[model samples]
Target chain A: MTAEIKWVFLYSLLTALATGLGALPFAFLRQVSTRGLALAESLAAGLMLGASFSLIAEGSHYGLTQTLTGGAFGGLLLLAGKRLLDGHDIQFGEIRGAGARRILLILAIMTLHSFSEGIAVGVSFGGGQKLATLITLAIAVHNIPEGLAISAVLRPQGASLLACAGWSIFSSLPQPLMAVPAFLFVETFQPVLPYGLGFAAGAMVLMVFLELLPEAYEKADSENVALWTTLALVAMVLFQTYL
Target chain B: MSSTPILSLLVAASVAALATTLGTIPLSFDLKAKRRALSAAYSVAAGIMIGAGYLLTLAGLESRPSACILGAVLGSTYSFWLRRVTGSKKFDDNDLESIPVEPKEVDRFLLQSSFHSAAEGAAIGAAAAVALPLGLFLAAALAVHNIGEGMVLTHRLYSPQATSSHPNAVPAPLLWPTSLPPAALVVVTKLPQIVLAMGTYFLIQVWPEFLPLALGFTAGALFFLTLTDLTPFAYGQGRREWVALLCSAAAALVVLGQSFFL
Candidate 1:
């Protein structure tokens, strides 16, 4: 096997390992407070903002017109998705059940979303190994919180730590699942690469503004929330410089 | 060309699977002592999201005046509509104290919320896979936000005993006082917001040409969240105002420092 191929495998493996390692803290420690939670959210917010800017900066090199068109298309897709999901009454806090039927329903809806992300990761790798590796690391670091959130949900149902971890891992299975095909047949799938990036960007921007920030505000003191948000914005700018 | 399609698939799948599973673990934290840590972490994540949206998404569209204007309008309108659709009457402070919650139900709610969050992450990731070449940062930002989100939601839903133990604690119950049960209201109110968020994403995907417009709209939405929603809530209690402001300034400094270094 070529060195690059070996590296790709190792990179993917490491990404997964890092994500799992991040979740280890949540397994044995269960006494997190609201304040602490808020702080963590703030840090994640900073990381995300930095990453988002990096994506756009990179995209701009492609040419203004192409980037603009991509941005517009991405924005519209996010709007439509928001409306459709709204029509279904599945907005924030919409589905809260552990029954087999409910889980199945939620899983089905989530699959569509997860698939989109996986495709994005796959296409990134198709671009170049270095760029792809960095993207993978970013994605993996972000995933740690996701794993913890999923586990928290199942904890009340007598789900063992193992079970919670299993579910958390299960949800992300699509990332690697989609990456392989895109990397192997880069040319054939090249057209979709920009679109993948756009789609992920759109969903992500929307998620942070609409869901994450609002939810954070709800839990915190309003003034504090606002002050912290501004601070968070500044932090994002700082992160951008590094990228 | 250098690798097999199957191997690539395995790599992507492994990463996704690992990220998802790891997300399920419950991180431990003390509710009181770690207030600064919690705030710092969340502020950082929030900073990432805001910075990403403006620098990456917004900056990308700076040259497109028409698109920018359109996106701003659409974003603001959508955000306002969401607020309206998911509106709930504010509960009195006294009302917040009276809401009864069962531990089992809280657990159920947390689980459900977690599932939805994962699904959201999946969707965001999948969409990035198809639309933009540099969507990894956006995905990463969302992932970070989700971790904080999971922590917040889990703590709120699971730790009644801790609250009760502290005599000085003033619990802000998670329920609305109107005839509608708070839990049900929570579910109802959040649906519209979620829809708007997800819908905005899909719209951007189909019309890649309007990426700037979409980003602008998303920015408007986030700005509203920061100014209207979060700011008011954070400062509602008068005593903590100074602390809050200081924390906020500290947060901004952290960002500025990051800009200078890594």
Candidate 2:
């Protein structure tokens, strides 16, 4: 295999293994501070804000009209995802099932989430290793909670801690499987690369608005989130100029 | 040193997957962090996304103006239509509470996570085609990005809907999860993006010339994404409202180099 693909596999494996670590927490702690949780989201938002603004500004370099058009479309794409989610009546209180069933249901959903994350990794690679690395880092950080989530369910069922951790790792098995094909096929996927980029961008922006920020507001100070975002923006700008 | 696309992508995918698995290994630890800390993390992450979106992706895509614009237009229109149909729910921040765990709720979380995965996967694949540098950068960034995302998902799973008796509970305020299954839901959600990304990448391979356009589309899509997804997170109740604006302006100045207003 090419060096690039080799790296991809290594990275994916590391992240998957990271998921298993979630179960370790069940051995000791029962609760995490709300502030800590909020910090994670805010930090992510800050980073996203900086990265996203720079992306738009960079796009503006080509032509104001072109970037604007892309921006508009990006917004629309996110709306579509929202529509899909909203159309379905997904009330947590309304649903009924045993813990095992609940776990399965959630497993199905999260698998899909992991799949998208894997694609995000592959697509970022199209930008370059730097971007891909950053994206990978983001995904890796997020996976901890994901693993914890697995344990949250399995642990309650009296499943062994090891079993819970094993399942957590199992949930994300598709990532490596998918990354291999994406990494090797870069040359082959040239024509539609632009569309893919646009699609990813659109989705990311929407994720920020519809998913992350609102959620952040639920837990922390909006101002703190905003301040952090600005700081991150400046940091990123410097990183880009200097790095 | 020679390798096939499938082999290469598989390797990369594996490494990323490993990161997630590794993250889970830490188990539960009591973090003393508060809302301020979490907010800071989110904002920083948002900034990173902005930077990657522009410096790493959009700037490069400028070469193909026509394709870029077309992609943006379509992305915006489609997104707009979707929002119009579903609409936003009136939400309150204080609605976080524990609720009954059920199978159906878990299903909802998974379905939502999966839909998002499709989008994320396609994005990763598209960016991957740009160049090795960008692909690598995206991989790293996404790895970091998932941490915050995972935390957020876990919170929902851990928190519950307001129980009827609780004074903190609202009839329909924050869209909190009702049970603990959501924790598992969060981890598994990252799965599909790789498959979708690789699949999409394969599709793009059929037509090599569209690479620039593809990149442009990514730019446009990200631009809109920033507006809708990341923007609101930066705003606060009062004095902090300017935080997002100021940060945005600074970013524009550095990135656009004086053409920020233009």
Candidate 3:
């Protein structure tokens, strides 16, 4: 209703939309070879690795113990979720079986993490409009790699580029949805921010080791996989540091 | 007064050498026992390395939290480079070229030894630069830690079958140069501590503020070892669930131990 709330919603929506840009690079590739897919997965694993570390670092700015404890719980939760999902045959739209399961899992994780980013955007606004705008832009830029990470997994498994982009945006939908409330109640959201960041980070890190890295290793040479993963991690960390 | 740091470096490096030597003493045992315990040992070592690195990271965070991440990136990048370079085929010439493309346990063990030694040496140097007592404490703790690592290194690298020249016979690469006698293997592996410790000493002397970054670097390197190398190798040994549990338990042990002591 208010102008400030409208702005918050709009900015958050913009951030969510930025995620679709991650899939843009996928357009340049004509076909996906096994090695290319493996490297892509490695890139995703590295991005997740860097993102998780950054999340922990950011959360530690508030409270280290809370962040780490939240990370442990987050990892456990993801593992438990994976176990539960394994019991049922999974289908996500046109995707099915293992591919469908992986898609659903990554989507669930990215969405879960976006909630923290949404709250972050909301909380930044409480500091001032200038701060809010800067944080929103940074997050929007950051979401591109995250989108790429999602598309890396989804596109190779037969999802269309359009579908991948749409799913990427969909995964980030939590930003606008959670931002309004967090902005309205900054005090309430601030305390829980670290835990949420930690949770997202923990789950993402576990997912990299459990899913992406393993798959990368299986499909490609271990040496190449390590190289791609490390390079991607270094790039992501530097990106977060500078941006 | 200025020489105290340099002097402490020698002391720390000497302690590490002694500790590592003691750790490798079990290499003389029968091969089957070592093979059986290999995965379990790696699992425990992985956990301890993570714990120790995390403790160092926490200490670094106390003064400069942000620097830890930068340090971590640098450290992990170093590890990645180390793994890449070491994994190359020309590290040595041996008859094991025809073996099935199983993971190179020899290269992994070599990287683990050198990488960890350098990281721990830097930690010792950085800590000592801050305070002699702190440096000495870390050296002693790491000395104890290196013993376990030494044990793992020897077990993984020194099996009787590894020394043979036949293509069909040698499953793993020989632990040392073929020309070098078996007795020299111990000397060669333990050599990294003195060299890396000296190098780290010079680094700290040049930049006093390198302490936190050094700690961060150590943590990052350790994490790389666990996630990229050890986890997969351990899993390959079979019983994924137990390997995971042991890794977790060892990590918890180090985390808890350091929390109380450090």
Candidate 4:
């Protein structure tokens, strides 16, 4: 293998593994308290909300014309998917298990967003070694909380520690797969990056306001929730100091 | 130049994927957190999500006012419509304390969780293509959030029905929707991120220009979620003003401060 390719792949691998490393904490805890669950949710909420917005700011590189167009398109896509699921047109009995179907539909949407990260890894390599190294480092550090986020929701749903780790890793598989190809043709792929970035950003934003935060609110009290959320945002933002 | 860059890219991506799975390994130990702790974690996660949307997604669009407005409006509007279509209701905050939940609701919740995870993975992938710095930031932020996710998902299985320690802990009132065992259901719900990660990455390389629309689309969807999905629940549960004001203020300050300083 070429030295450059070797380093790029190695860095990506390390980054991906960091996600599993983040999962280690859940293995020790056999049970959780109501208070603990709330705390965990708040933390995840903070991290996710922050990241989603950060993505938007980054996407602004292209000007609002692209941003709004991309964002609006993303929103429509989600609605289309949601409507399909919520359409409730199909009788529950017709689908073998409506629950599984619903789960699958959600999975499809999740996949739409994840594919972009893999491309990001690939694209960063095009920026050259120094830039790639920095990007890799950032992504690796970032995966830890992502791992935690997955475990946060799944653990409460009754998933095992191993399962949470496995799923968390599973969600991030795109990074390595796309890195190779994106590195091969940087110029060709450059133009589309903003739109893809915007799409992911929009989807996640909706997720926070629509899915995660509400869930957290339902789980935690309306009173202490904001404080916990603030703490998490502050913690995650701390990493930016290194930038 | 021993070989093509391809070799290195493959390895890098693989390790990144491994990190995600490895992070979950800790859940096997005997340690545990309480309900309040989980709530704290979720709250943190929520904050992170809000910060990410504004800082990365929304702010990135500042230059293009038209696109930004379009994305915001569409996202919020569609989400509103979706809620109506889904039959999902925001339980009044007044009744949040007394509301009953069942296994079916849990299943639905699991499904939704998977959806978001997949979407997040895609965000990272998309960011990588456009701006390495942005991608790095998003990825780092998400990794931190995932740790809590690992713990929270494990906590979801605990039921008041299964335990005698907390009498006041209400047993879930909503019926579990399917015949599938909880364990299996959990696995099914959690496995999609890998596919999403890989798929999104691959797609971006092949269809580069699509990213703008794609990114904007994600923003719109998220906006919708915020409007339809999270806001109601948040408003209903707490003193709306405090919850809205504090969280929004904190998130905004963090992003704006970074914009100037960073």
lDDT string, candidate 3, B210-230, tens digits: 777876776666566555555
Best candidate (score: DockQ): 3
Candidate 1 C-alpha lDDT tens digits along B1-262: 2234224323333333233323234556554433444444444444443444353334434446456545544544554454444432121111112323343234334333433333333333223323332234445444444444433433443335524654312233354223433233334323432343344445555666766655555554454343443223222322132323332333233223222322
- Per-candidate DockQ values are 0.05, 0.03, 0.13, 0.03
* Candidate 3: tens digits of C-alpha lDDT, residues A124-205: 8898999999999989988989999999999888888999899999999999999999999999999999899988987886
Which one is best on TM-score? 3
Interface RMSD of the predictions, in order shown?
13.0, 13.9, 4.6, 13.8
- Residue-by-residue lDDT tens digits, candidate 2, B69-99: 4554444344434433443211113122223
- Per-residue lDDT over A38-130 for candidate 2, one digit per residue giving the tens place of the 0 to 100 score: 544454444444444444543443454444344445545555545555545453332333434434544544454455456556656777888
TM-score of chain A of each: 0.59, 0.50, 0.97, 0.81
Cα lDDT, model 1, residue A60 = 40
Per-residue lDDT, model 1, residue B146, is 45
Which parts of model 1 are misplaced by more than 4 Å?
A: A1-10, A25-51, A62-168, A227-243, B1-53, B56-262
State iRMS for model 3. 4.6
**Residue A181 in model 1: lDDT:** 65
Alpha-carbon deviation at B58 in model 3, angstroms: 10
